[model samples]
Target: MRVEQGFQPTPYTEGNPFTTDPVLPNLLKRLLPRDVHEEVYGDLERFGLKVLTTLHDLTSKTSEPRVVQYDQWGRRIDDLQTSEGWRGLKAQMQEEGVIGIPFERKYGEFSRVYGFMKQFIAIGDSDVISCPFAMTDGTSRVLELVGSPAVKRDIFPRLTSRDPSLAFTAGQWMTERPGGSDVSQTETIARPVSNASSPYGPVYRIDGFKWFSSATDSDIAVALARTGPPESGSRGLSLFLIPLRRPLIRPVDAPRPPALTNNIKIHRLKNKFGTKILPTAELSLEGAEGYLLGEVNQGVKFITPVLNITRIHSALTSVGSIRKCLAIATAYSSVRAISGGRQLLKDNVLHVAELARAHLTYRALTHFVFGVVLLLGKTECKVATDDEVLRLRLLTPAVKAFAADKASGVMEECMTMLGGQGYMEESRIGTVLKDAMVEKIWEGTTTVLSLDMVRAAAKPGVLHASASTISNMHQWANTIVSSCPADLVHRLAERLATLRICVTEVISAYTNPSTPLLSRPTLALFAYTTSALYLLEHAIWAHESGEATANTDIEVFRRWIDEGGLLPALQDVRRVKTAGADRTKMDAEIVYGNTSTTQVVDDLPISARL
Candidate 1:
């Protein structure tokens, strides 16, 4: 007797990300001017559909790039071959003005909001094309701020062009064998070429090996090289714009073959664990012609704009990855069955609780990243107040580090929500998990970014200004919570007090160097406190405005304040403070395991020993 086949799970289908997203529409409506929101609303909807359809299809069909080192004739002709689908995505991004919207400034201060909202929707499925777009966006900003007239006139237009054929993506070649994030150890050398003449700037011959060059297929690049004594460190480095390909020299009617600029050689594409579709490579620059970007030995100073912009991009990507994973899990849960097909996954209380908790964190981070994006737009438009600028400075690194640090865990939880299918690459959730993992290490590792946060807060008046902003947010939230349930009101008061105490400790640590503070914990405390306040602010607004999701927003805020989010950071701070003289030894023991002669708790489980 043949038995009927078991049930087949329904296929997961994604909707237009922008339209289907529960939080983004309300966010834009609240943050953007009515006219601006109305103007871009249709475009966002159409682009969202395109992202799931055309963009997704294109990326799904493509494979990672491959390199050919030589021609059949044994001549040294390095050829990089990417799939047609990859090229199609690049063209689509250019046509959509993914990098051009902010440069156009059509919406003024809200342009970045509009631009990055599109980026947030598209990045998850862009097949890592956003990697090139980030560097390209940063390059355009650099050019606008410091490029010479000739350079801006020649290249800036291409960088920000909406026309696919005219657009030029840029590579940021900063990493070398000797230095990764530590630009101080950069060994690439740049020498002035007196005989050469260029309209861009004074030409220089750059010589070095770039160990990791993302967007290797780009038209031009900004590289950092030393011009001063080797020991001068970062102070000796200068920024240069290097044309990646030689200008075509076509005689009267003859066709000349294309070539790499100077002696630039494509060594090989990196076999990375994620973002495989992007062309990251090791490059050899033997006397490559480059143009000076700013004053000599000011590379570190000039590249600050690029670093800031890219860090924001990293934060956006981190949050976007989580959103995509959550979307997948949410969509899949409706159809996936459990308990011998008697119940759907979404109806299961335990499963729904995990998704709800993940959603809470996602909501908080969404506000945190977009808050910085809005500040960036205002600052770029020269309309930001002094306090806003200070807040931006302090929050940029915190957002990047915090969002990246949290995204992986949230994504892993989402993956688990999908059960065994989540572990398969076919689900795309696993792929996103791998890609999101890179954001933590991309712009800067959590440790490095935490230190950067400390440096920013250490600046004169920065900590005070930032704390003032959070305090104001807390005051507003304090008033709003008064109308809520008494328990929520109590929780809000307690959390606000904790926030104040955390801020005091942070200020004391930065102001009085004698106060010991771990950079990672300090950054975490700052990020969580600020994020908690932002979530509360959003909840207040939703409640006051009578938004449809007001109940959910209030609940998220409630959970976040009540031992859901800020507890980890508070606990970390307490652990550090109470450790006192034993902090160093305890940290070492935690990392390396206790190597002392202390009696082993063999009777207890391994987990209890810690």
Candidate 2:
């Protein structure tokens, strides 16, 4: 018997990301010094094509890491055996400086821009190895803030090494069973050791269970343990660096240290719906050696640096994944045959429209996330002004939450464009969707992040500063739009005005005690306004800078606005308080109804009732 094959999509071409997105190089050209941009761009191009593409292929073939608790001789040895493909890819990442780029600072002020652009591309092919990379980057940032001289001398170099043999990854162990994001309820206990033997100073013994440890096979971890009495909450907790294995340093010339237990026991791995390529495990630390970081009882404040870094990672993961999805969907639509003997790309107006919108979304999110990345780079380089610093603090949570949420919706639409095939495991659409969902939940949930935005806006001068920045961006956009088609420019101008009004209402709602219910909606409105401003700016730049596809870029901006991209919330300042009060009343009524009635009942034996 003979079998017939069906239509299949040609695989997406993997090459230099700089070439893939002309806008990226153009953005870099404007942001970085010419000499620095050229060098950084060249190196990243080579790494992206030669190293990242190969690793992406390898990652697709690798299985999840398996944990072996005992040796064949019945000796206790907790070993995490990962696939050759995973190991090979990890080695390549080290050699390519995927995790080292930002910390190394070889490219100067624009180092982070170059580094983040590389990360943005690498993540698409990263097989969720980016999970560990995110935590590792966060750990590095934390150490930079508080690590002792010895810790910095011995660990920072190894962490930032481009040589695989000497490099190490770090994990973040923060969550516990009883307390999810509420670190105030942390139950982990740390007892001081007067004369402990360790490279890091002020050693402590940790005893607690971590509910979620994403990178179980990592060399070291940053954890939180209560150094004060049980009632101390977040204030009583302290941050500690614990080596997963003793003698954490890996010297290139010497043989790797012998398998030494660190009293960190892996209870079980999480059977997650997505990111199966990364191993997330539950761990129990009993008498585990850890070195206290920073002053005792000041862990919460210090941990913010790490969280800030990881949150950016979460945003990158979101934007990168959606970009990949758009690429796949667009390519598949171009080739797949449909009605009237026409390809889906050419014949289907609805499909074409979907692709156009997805493209617009991808562009907007790219700018939003990258904008944050640039701010972070400036902050790190000590070149940022006070206003920029304040904007960075305000925008971080907003961008992370908004981008992650928007990516999920965009990916879903892209999946729908692929029809039934997108649902299959072999297509990997479902995998990306699941992974994107995790990004929304991790780092911080939408609700939690919205509250953070409220807090930031409430800070003195922050709201006004953000408003002024948006106004300046709008003026610049209007100047660039002057040369474009009149109707399109007018529409954009209208949207920009709505954005301004919405921002004012959002700030007002947040500040007023009676309008607590407006917090989430206000944050959403703020995000929409910010995203629209970014898209407008990108369109303006494309037109003025004579980018390769200026006309198409302008059209994307038009479509984005035409499709109701920047529509403000219906609840403005006038209605926010009323809506909030109504919501609270309804909620209370549900819990305890206004019509109260009571009835008494006599208990009966179970057998008699039956």
Measured on C-alpha atoms, candidate 2 has an lDDT of 0.76
In candidate 2, stretches whose alpha carbon ends up further than 4 angstroms from where it belongs are 4-18, 197-199, 250-260, 464-491, 562-564, 568-577, 587-610
Q: On residues 1-610, what C-alpha lDDT tens digit does candidate 2 reach at each position?
A: 3344664445444345556663576667767887897787787677667644586678667898878878899976767777777777777777777678888777755778887788787665667777888888888888887899998999877777788777888899889988899898999999999877666869899999999999787888899999998788899999999999866764568654322467888887889888877879889898989999999999888788889989998999999888777766876776677774556554688778777777777887887788888889889878887766777888899889988888888898888887888787766677888877899889889999988887887675666435445433233334534545555566467655555565555555655646566677767767666666666667666766777777776666566555635553534435565764467888777888643331111244556556
Q: Poorest 10 consecutive residues of model 2 by lDDT?
A: 595-604
The model with the greatest lDDT is 1
Q: Which stretches of candidate 1 lie over 4 Å from their true place?
A: 1-6, 248-259, 465-491, 513-517, 589-610
What's model 2's lDDT at 546? 78
**Clashes by residue pair, model 1:** none
Q: How much does candidate 2 score in TM-score? A: 0.89
Clashes of 1: 0
Residue 83, candidate 1: C-alpha displacement in angstroms = 1.4
Residue range 1-610, candidate 1, lDDT tens digits: 3354665568888878999987899888878988889989999999999999899899787788998888899988878888998899999999989899999999988999999999999867877788899999999999999999987787898989988767789989898887788988998999999999888888999999999999888888998998999999999999999888777222324432333546789988999889888889999999999999989999988888888999999999999998899999999989888898889989999999888889888889998899899999999999997767877888899999999999999999988887788999988888888877889899899899877877887665676435335432233334544545554456466665665665666665554443245678878877887787677767767777888988788777768767555777767766666557776788788898886634556656778976
